[model samples]
Target: MFTIGLTDHLEGPPDRPSGEIFGEVADLVQLADRLGVRYAWFSEHHAHAHQGHLPTPLLLALHLAGQTQRIRLGTAIICLNLHHPLDVAEQVAVADVLTTGRMAVGFGSGSTPEESALFGSVVADDRERQTRFSEALRVIRSAWSGDWSGNVPHAFSVPPHRTLPVPAADLPGRCWVAVNSLGSARIAGDLGFNILFSHLRTPEQYRDYCAAYRAAGGEGLVAANRPVFVGPDDATAFARAEPALRTLWRRFRQEGKIPAETTEPANPEDLCGHPINFIVGGPETVARKLCELHEQSPFDVANVEVRWAGLSHERVCDSLRRLMEDVVPRIANAKSLTGRMPR
Candidate 1:
């Protein structure tokens, strides 16, 4: 079965007054849990005024752990290069316990140059960054296994100590790497970790990544992050999303972060330009498109980003509710639906 999850964005209303976004997010998580979504992933961005709303996803995930029962909570891509590996491992391990094993950690080499500078760190070149990221994963996995030995040094002078109250025997968490390029996916596969392909590439690009993962002898969950919105009517959905969508693309372009597209289309259909970038429409339409994409790549999970560009909390929540209550069930019932199936 394919898993369905929401990606939480803490930024609030773009042009209207709305209450706290994160507070609404907590409510959204509960709704998703009740509606039977499989997971909820939160992002990590620091010091980007417009985007760094959620700097502490772990803290937020802990709060979500209390509010949710069955849905898995995860970091979409935590900036592992900015913090000590042991510190991240400790926090994630505790979160896993709190979530009772329903946790997935997706690590990435930090993307934004501004975020890196604000964190007072140099963004390593791709090669160096990938190496550090891979090593950090090894360290984190070792820490979780409670097998601290070998090249790992023991602080004999400090005092003999284990990390802390481990979770119950049955509660074990899985880890994933958020990859943007084929090389990143291959590295993730080589490490035997799950892959979380960011929603910045085309379906063709992801197909190649998935093929490489299989070829590399990696077997685990593979998912992609895609923006999703399902409204009762197509016209209403597109009308509401178009302005904000344009603003979003413009902002990314201003920051020189637009994806591999040559030019931005004046129309909504051309918005993503890349096939796998975003999913926007009514439930059935979006479902059909998603299924078509799934037929090509066959992802095990789909992380839906329902909140983006300051959409109203109510609007975002309503869209999510519609997706969970309406679109999700249809997608679940349709056996032949392809692309990234929901879990």
Candidate 2:
């Protein structure tokens, strides 16, 4: 069946205590689960200045596994360079067991230079970072096997043994590697792993990315994610989303996180016009765009974000409700008419 997923920064303003923010995320997740969103993806960030909380997405996923019966738990990415692959494998295994095999994992090299510095990761250059990530992935997959080939390190020096609640033998097919470049996409394909690319890039980029993936033997899931907002109508959606969109853009620019060619867009219309990479519209409007996107890129899953720049939990839930109830079905129909429906 075709599937949809939701992702979040689990952001809190700098003023609030961290605990309250986490609590709010839990409650919001419960609401999303009830609304029938398929997957709950937590993003990773550490010591972000504006409070991009939830540094340990795995812990949050594990904590909610018991509470959420239907929603699968995921990490949009677990930065692999700094983490011990064995630890990552074991934790993911435990999460898989806890969620009854409901796990969709995404791995990445690293984020900003500061984040890499804090972790003491060897991000001297892109090649070095990719080397670290590639090795970590190898060790993680080895650690999940019955033989667990990563045992060489622990056996020689470290001394941890297999613990309780090992992962199921089979992981869900949706496991992914977060990719933004042609190289990452090519490697992800060669490794036979699925790839997750952001909507921040254009649909044309994704079309090229997917073609490269297929050429290199990638045969698993292909996911695309975007900052998305839906409302009762276009005017209301634009009004509610404008400030948040601008705020997010400004921060991205200041941090040098956005592409150099882009400027912070002040107009809501400009933000929604595909230049800024956000989907903001009424139900039908959003639906049409999603259809256009699937026709072009045909991502297996559209992992969307409803919470950004201090949107209220109720508002996020409402957006998800429309997404599930109205947008997704129309997208499917659009796919059929265009003869490019997702699997």
Candidate 3:
């Protein structure tokens, strides 16, 4: 099956009440659950008030688990280098127990210098950060198996004792590693973790990342994250999502994430020509784009972002409905006819 998943950074304006944002996310996940979305992923970001504000994904997953019946809840990533691996292992284990083993986790090295400073674990560079991340992940997996014994500096340290609240037996099967580099992808594969590719990458990049993962013996899922918004038709979808997309682009521009030479997109055509390829259209259009992506990269799951930059709760819910109820069936049909789905 061409499985589809949902991911959210819990983005909202600073002025918006946190409760409203969380409530809306809960509603979206519940909607997806009822509509048979395979997974619901939440991201973690610290002190990010207006954007990427959901700092505790496991907590949110536990909360959502009580509300929804079937959708598997996961951390799109937890910045493992910033916190104790033992603590994370404990929380993940508890979540598995309470959610009846419907929990998943994606671990990554922490990003941004400010976050590292705040966490009191400032790494010298990406290499050091990844080293720390590798160590932390090993400790976490060891703790899950109750066989932990290592003391990596600035990563983790403990005496000869098993961490409390052992994880579910199948928890490691659900572990993922968020990766932007081939080295990280290989590491994720070599360590028996699934791969979560960055949304910013192109299809060619996805192919290369998948190749690296497979070369390193990765046999688990390969998830590609992308912003997706579907509506009744192409024009309606573009019009509805463009404003929020503009808001997102402007913020990224201000943060130096977008090139200054790039102009704000005026319409769907402009968006198609822009650097970021957001999947914005009606059901058929969205479905076609996703199929094209799969044909190019051959991934296992489409981890989509349906909400962005102050987009309304109602609009998001509608998009999720169209995506799951409409777009997904089209993909499945295409796969059946063309045999394009990854084996």
Give the lDDT of residue 315 in candidate 1: 84
Question: 240-307, model 2: which lDDT tens digit per residue?
Answer: 87877887776666666666678655566775545458898898998887777777777777888788
Per-residue lDDT over 128-221 for candidate 1, one digit per residue giving the tens place of the 0 to 100 score: 7777776776666667666565555332112224655554443322678887876678777887888887677777878898888878767777
Query: Order of all candidates by TM-score, from best down to worst?
Result: 3, 2, 1
For model 3, the stretches where C-alpha displacement exceeds 4 angstroms are 149-155, 272-275, 336-343
Worst 10 residues of 2 by lDDT: 149-158
Alpha-carbon shift of residue 128 in model 2 (angstroms): 2.2
Candidate 2 yields a Cα-based lDDT of 0.75
Q: Pick the candidate with the highest TM-score.
A: 3
**Clash counts for the predictions, in order:** 10, 0, 0
Pairs with steric clashes in candidate 3 = none
